[model samples]
Target: MTGAWWAAAPAMLVSAAILLVPGLIATAPLRLAWVARIALSSAVSIACIGIAGVAFSLFGVFFAAWQVVLVALVLGVVAWLIRGWVPDAPRERVRWWWLASAWVLSALLIAVVAFWGVASPEQFSQTYDNVFHLGAISHILAGGDASSLTLRTLIEPQRAWAPYPSAWHSLVALNVQLCGVSVPVAVNATWIAVCATVWLPGVAWLAQLIARPFESGRVALIALPLGTAFGAMPYALLSWGTLYPTFLATALVPAAIAIPVAVWPPRFRVRVGRAVLAGAAGLAAVLAAIVFAQPRVLATWAVMMAPFVLYFAWRAYRPAWRAGGRHRRRAVTALVAAVGALVVAAGVGFAYVVFRLGLFERPLDDRLGGPQAKASQSVAAGISQVLGQAWPAGSTGTISFPSIPLALFVIVGIVAVWRGRRLRWALVSYLALAILFVIAAGADDVLTKLLTALWYKDRYRLSSALPVFGVAFAALGILVSARWLGHRAVRRRTGAVAFAWGTALVSALTLVVSGGSSAIAVVFALPAASAADEVVSVRQIQFLQDVGRIVPADERLLGDPWDGSAMSLLFGDREPVFPHVNGQWDPHRLLLAQRLGEIETVPEVCQALDALRVRYVVYNPHEFGGGDPIGNQFFAIHDAVGAGLFEPLLTDGESTLYRIDQCGRLPAR
Candidate 1:
């Protein structure tokens, strides 16, 4: 197989092993045709990664493509052994071409955005967070650890586990091992897969799950491509902060929603009672997926879906509690559904709380507080920013509001679904989530502090729910509006069906085309870091590589804890003296301000470096001394350079590497 195909082989395997078989078993009872089954399966499959990762950790094994094959085989056997998955009477048949067309269109749209922003040597996001993501991947590849639990030992305090979700990183590492792709290529592949394999298919599944007319699945499918167009999403995330983990986690949201929707719908009963059981399992899997990939995403989704979960519980049990003799089975079923869904939801939440999975023990940096911590945005300004009417230059990520037309559609859908059991869940949940977003952004210190207990006063992250639910609701709105137009015009106009379809198609297409065009233009239009910044970054990586040629891979480096310092750990395979990002491990920022700021004399500077075991000092005049002004305060080396206590090991114009072993100062030993 060609290398590209070789890289794709694992994706195909993952789809089959994790998605295809179980999806067949779970949805078979409903006799949901191909489109629904495939969409739901896509979600279940992503969740399976978390499960597989945990299993491997227990065995202390590295994740590879073949590991999925092993999991698939076991799941297949379990699937074979399970019974009672009786196929129901067939629903209205839909043509396969609609699904294929929608899939292709969604794939093309996702690809356009991904390829347009594709990072390369000359082209890359200039955001600050990219370093942590790129460096984490490199550390995994070089350090030879893929276990999500243990991998944090690379940069975190020794033996102290950091609960930063590593499922995304682990998957990238697996791709590298099995596909023999470079770390960058593997990173790109993970990004593409999250969008194409999970997000697109996931949206389709969610639409079909709740659509009133089953065939609205097709309309929902057609309408969902508009999802990529939202200003705060897929592209906005890339430009704003290069939030790789957030991107991965949010991409999995629709799939996460799909897991529960698959079961406990229509009404609750015992011959097929295991459906609720299956829902519980699927929910568990999705929770596992979220916890492993990005735990905060789980919290975010949980908060967003709080209302939906409550409504789900009420619907599942009310029928059973209210029904009589003839409705006894109905009552039993309803009770079962309610109990199962509620228990699972509560169980997941309980585990997260009890386990303290967020690693909150690590202190939050006082220097760089939460998004709104430094300076409060007035509630009015925050709302304006969230709606994309205006953006504060310093905000962490993109926040979007519905455009006028899109906003109109969303209101229509909300009203249309007011009485709909099938779709009503979306409305309540969205309102609940939106309220949280507003509260988080409120300027009142007391309110922000109260909400901080949820996500550290990070309002923008909560604002992500807008684009996610906004796209789906807007699509549904389009579907409802088209149907209304079709019904009203059937008697009043010629070719009413054709007219509704055409009007809907044109309107939906406009959103997709316009959104896609705007995203492409915006991303490509952003100035790449100045040619000077690029040269500085490229030379810094190259300089580190050259240093690696001479020093051991384990050499401890001391540099400013800014973007300038990324090269030492990312490219040079050396751990920096402090891996500081918003008070991650070290408290007080003492190491950053103290060790790097005041060193002057030979013995004094050497003693400080010895305490931290920092052997080399990197002075990138542009990145540290000159590039990012913050680097100077964090690691001020002007006095050391002036005093000649540091010996210049290498110099490239403005960048220099200094050996600390000068003035007869020997190694600590």
Candidate 2:
């Protein structure tokens, strides 16, 4: 653990350097102070590293340790030059006890969520996506290159344009290089770095933005604990997609939504510095970073950003055009310019996505998605799905749930904010996002297509962003109630004292309602199996480790990718004959799986090996996804061994490592 943390240090430092200037530049525009500045900086830092990796790749940098370090140094110099542009630092320090308390609670919850159910062997999320994710890491490590363009060409030859973001891979790869820890340990620690640097800070900044209307730090303070309390998200995604990148992107959603809205505020105001330009540029870069990370997450962000856009448009135009304000003429002119700028930015981003990213090369395809998993759940049904654990069964099992508590906060928040004229935009924004979540619950039809631009259709991923608005309203609800209940006591005690007590009471209630404790317990109940765990037992892993010692790292191993092939590639530090790339391009891998099962003779198996250009075959009976056809393939390997076709270099109870190079001659036939 200590070694892993030490390894993660350089990655963290590099990431922070990448974010510092942008974070400072975004401060005044974002009103990022105290903890929020740190949060935005951390999230932006992650984006900076991602941008650096792809940028370096585009320049044909091999993404070796030295090249990446040089890139980081370049970014550091740029940040230093820009550091002079930011001048809104507080003249005198104000101790924000509320921000401090929020930090303590948010850190506590993030730590619990980061490590709670996580353990060794399967140090990372052991969900389905683990196969591709782990393979991608090992795939990059195998060739010792992290070039985004050519990273996976070794395992996946078809596209050579595998556009998956290098944020997660790049960070892990850097850790592996600098830290000297195994990939799995580095992978899990990378999760912690993402939490501390991005999600925790992003949410803190977002909570401040949502609570800005009240001019109350209490809202920001209470929001985080309540937000982190919701278990299904951030934690649930671990089991769901093994969604590492999605988690990082979702963490930045609040900042993405908030910064744009903040740029176009409710009323006409003049900024008297380079901040106007620097902040806009910084925010644009931040948005681009996420589009690089996971383009699909931008959909939820747009939905959440819409009401704010509407608010900005209304405040900028209606009064000014009607000649209602003191500076009506100037305001109207500014409004037109602001709107025009937005149009230009939108056009550029659209061009980049449609022409540059190639995101929808096959949009309706299963990989990119069509109207497949349409939103079917209404609000209630969706809540049920979040809480419905397949554990303990019946009476006691359903005891762990999120709907009741979250719904309580939802209702309370709605009622509290329903009448605030100043918060109408905030209230409307929250309601709009909630409605989007509901609509996305079941239908990925026309509405979903229009909103998400057919980029992604799965509602599960969108739900991860739910806490942004949910926590906003939840904290507001608690704040409003606390203030109202404390109004009378203001006379007897100082208003601050009453407010503090009220905040404490509501915070406790939120903790219980968010089901933070239950969420932790639920993670344990949810089953997780790594590629190694899924396809091989302990004895099998033990034998493979021994075989890894004998099989030179230069030799590529031949085995079915869907089985424990990644474990060999990952643990053995050797490439596999097959790694899971998209199937349309690699149907031959399945054909190979089928052929291995169909072949009988030692020479025939050798012929198959010749195609892959390999001499080693690792076989396990309990290959993932067992059924008749696959069973037959397992039988073929067994029979080939029985025929004395290949020499078994190593054997466990039901698994064998065969050295195909030493196979005996086939009988005359």
Candidate 1 residue-wise lDDT, 116-151, digit = tens: 433341233434565566656666666545556765
Alpha-carbon deviation at 264 in model 1, angstroms:
1.2
TM-score of model 2 relative to the true fold? 0.76
Q: Write the per-residue lDDT of candidate 2 for residues 1-669, one digit (tens) a residue.
A: 123344445544443343444444434344335655666565555555565666666766556555544444555565566655443422113247655666555644554544443334234443346667777777666655555555546445666676666567766776676666677666765665566556655665565555565543544555555555544355545544567777777877777765554444422233434554545655765676676566667656665665565566667667777776566777777767767656775675566556665546756332323322454445566545433311111111222243444455555666766666545666676555545545565555554544444335455465567666666666666556556666664332234324333443443344334443343333323222222334444465566677788776666676655456556877666667666523333544444554554444334545545544566777665444342332444344445555666667887656678876443332232
**Global fold similarity of model 1 (TM-score):** 0.76
Candidate 2 positional error at 51, Å: 3.0
The segments of candidate 2 whose C-alpha lies over 4 angstroms from its true place after superposition are 1-32, 58-105, 113-115, 118-122, 151-155, 213-219, 266-274, 323-380, 383-400, 403-407, 439-456, 487-536, 581-591, 594-612, 625-645, 662-669
Q: What C-alpha lDDT, on a 0 to 100 scale, does residue 630 get in candidate 2?
A: 21
Worst lDDT run of 10 residues, candidate 2, spans 389-398
lDDT of 1 at 308: 70
Q: Candidate 2: give the clashing pairs.
A: 39-201, 374-442, 375-441, 375-442, 375-443, 376-441, 376-442, 597-633
